[model samples]
Target: MNTKMFCYQCEQTVGCTGCTGNAGVCGKKADTARLQDELTGALIGLARAVDGAETISKRTSQVIMEGLFTTVTNVSFDDAAIETMIQKVRAEKERLVPDCSKCQSSCGKTDEYDMQQLWDANEDVRSLKSLILFGIRGMAAYAYHANVLNYEDAEVNRFFCEALFKIGYEESVETLLPVVLKVGEINLKCMALLDKANTETYGTPEPTAVTLTVEKGPFIVVTGHDLKDLQLLLEQTEGKGINIYTHGEMLPAHAYPFLKKFSHLKGNFGTAWQNQQKEFDHLPAPILYTTNCLMPPKSSYADRVFTTEVVAFPGAVHIDEKKDFTPVIEKALELGGYKEDQILTGINGGTKVTTGFGHAAILSHAGTVVEAVKAGAIRHFFLVAGCDGAKPGRNYYTEFVKQTPSDSIILTLACGKFRFNDLDLGEIGGLPRLMDMGQCNDAYGAIQVAVALADAFGCSVNELPLSFVLSWYEQKAVCILLTLLHLGIKNIRLGPSLPAFLSPNILNFLVKNYGIAPITTPEEDIKTLLNHNK
Candidate 1:
């Protein structure tokens, strides 16, 4: 079939290749995809303008981060919104180099890049640049969240423009490869920035059990990964006879001290982001999307959707920067939730799930954990984390976690944990066998825990008895994977499948150097991972 668009940035691309028809696998229309490409191209133009400028201001960095974030999969499907973003990006470039557009000579150095060039480039070059582009796109989400909390990192901000500039400028493998890997190195810092922002703003997360029940009352289900939006919604709905529940990646908000203190901040609603369509069909409460993991809303509940920040969809009431959630609050009161308290079970049939094993929480139990490992009570550690998707093979994660030895512990984050998070994995030496380390960005906490464990064991992280069996769906996973590779951690088993954008040569390089491979059967993978040494 002749293709109207080309996208393979997510795990569930059409037929494990590219989505090339009227709409992408995530339901992004071709026109919307084109606009996203244009937005991305315009972001590169803004970065180009920053090149000859005196200094990078906070506003310039914010524009770049917001632009790149808007283009991430399932973030913004509204073409009007994307066009507006493109205009904003162009305006920023104009502010940066005012005379470039007016100059008679017209060097075109500050002109917006044609993204089709990167898409149609040589296969290897395309793959490398895709790594840098998509990796930074993921990093932008983290940086944006931090910026909202009034926490900004200059190096992380500077790298955003640098990566975008390289995506449009550098081509050779030798020249691009270092920049590609640098994305991971910088993302580590970005994730850390977000980590500090979240913990300091909300207080360290503590282990808390969140119910899967939607109580009988007016309520709002906040999805995506924005805590600030959720906080605002909670404050506005306080004592207004409304309850708030989290959905998808926002499930971890229940663990934070500040959020948990809200009496109305009740439980979690649905499972992962992929299940939103069925789970939300005629859902009585409105869902507020603060960031990505947004599938196009089905007509049944489309009217009940509210979006804020970079997340946008046509017809959904968007809560702007003012953060007034009155519309969402009124809608919830109108819907009136369920007639009775409805108990919802996770994919594994458990009625409640626990989260908030952040690095601080986990480290507080460091003595117990170290003793458990030294005493042979803990055999291994498996981090079965990453984004969840609608793909079929994702059941592998559920089974992998289920089949883990009773003596082992599972460290998970992101929505992927919804698979087996409800299952009773029991505990080892006073620590629950399964630990939810907050959201996907909480991978920072997991890294910290690993590093601390390695230090306690007098070994490197690779020598510790820990493994990363990850499931990835979107660009955020791309950046996190690159971060793992950047840390030189080896033998990472990634699935439901490898990224479609990974060319054969790049895949080979990752496999040979970092021991990355697609996941196989639960039994085989578990045995191999258990017996294998790095």
Candidate 2:
């Protein structure tokens, strides 16, 4: 196999196999892919170095988390940025064991492990290790967000090094399998950490209606999953005569009291991240990407794109840690937005969408929900959530939501909801049939709600008429799915595609033990789920 690179970390990989040519399906070039692999290998070596240290510092864990996050699909595409990350990993290793590299004995313990070894390993081993690696990469994103908000969990931080060390050196199935499942266990804690950070900082999200109308004036469109970046932007742009609109995963920011207080924080701008290139074409407003799901910018609106945090693209203005929004604001003002309010609608052609149904908001009405459930007003619950991508079969989600029985409640998170979120599913017993539960990290809230429901009903979650019809695209979805599996949840129907990295043996194990299966047609799956619920 004479290939330029090997990458299957995302669901949209080439032909459901690895992306081995010049660029990945996410538009990451081969050079960038190679640099990311190198960065991962370097992080592994740093983890190995930390293993010998008496203690792991917060900074050490932070670097490990950042490095892992940097390699997640569609994140850092800049070779220079990836190389800088590699250097940061090495610098962290040197800080931990200054004299180790200077040793004449030259033990391989501290040397960077080549990622190609893992990529070329036995099928089952590769599958399991990929699960662990991808799961933590997703977990790191949550941990990073929480860390920015001054939340730190020593256990979560330590597991980064432990997972990296195992990925680099461990080969036994017995050893790696538990580590793979443990990624899910740790990620649950990480999501909870992020949940605490978000709710405490921004205030617990409440149900709020976010319009799709872009008010006339200078406006900046904020996308990706960073609420802190959105808050900072909201603060800096307040009273600047510039309106702010949430895009993609940032749509949940509107539900936060601290964020919604900004009068200029008008409404949502666009749909999921995959549609950005089309949606952003010649957009008059500046678009700021605070995190991943960034596509290669088309020349039309390339000049209006600004990246902050770990997100970097060549030639686009990069916002450093100083968090200044001058350039973005100035761009917004210069572009002079629409002459009139541009009314945008979701894919389902609805002008308004609602969000902020976090655990607190949902649980606040738990008594009502419980009464409805027991009275048969709400027959079942469907968690139709996960990442959205530019793929063919994703219409399955839109159709699935539409075909879901009127008596069932649709609990959604992440961008996948963009498919049918705007459709009027009506309400069940005073509650909207569809509830958007924040971002993908807000999967924590969904889990909390499920567990609470189960406790109220005196049964396990799997026995509570709840079904997970998830659509995954990238690593974040991977970690969330693993978290579900870790909790002993069963019969999850995942699509638009299963991960390419899953070997037949590992897939069989999951199918046999966990009852995980790829999604079939929405009509068939809905009928099957309803029948199963009965």
Residue 4 displacement in candidate 1 (angstroms) = 0.7
Instruction: Summarize candidate 2's per-residue lDDT along 36-70 as a digit string, tens digits.
Output: 88898998889888775556798898898889889
TM-score of 1: 0.98
Q: What is the TM-score of candidate 2?
A: 0.98
Q: How would you encode candidate 1's per-residue C-alpha lDDT over 120-204 as one tens digit per residue? A: 9999999999999999999999999999999998888888888888888888989999998899999999999999999899998
Error at 288, model 2, angstroms: 0.5
Kindly report which residue stretches of model 2 are placed more than 4 angstroms away from their true locations once superposed. Answer: 1-3, 52-54, 102-106
Clashing pairs in 1: none
Candidate 1, superposed: residue stretches over 4 Å from native: 1-3, 52-54, 104-108
Deviation in angstroms for 47 in model 1? 0.6
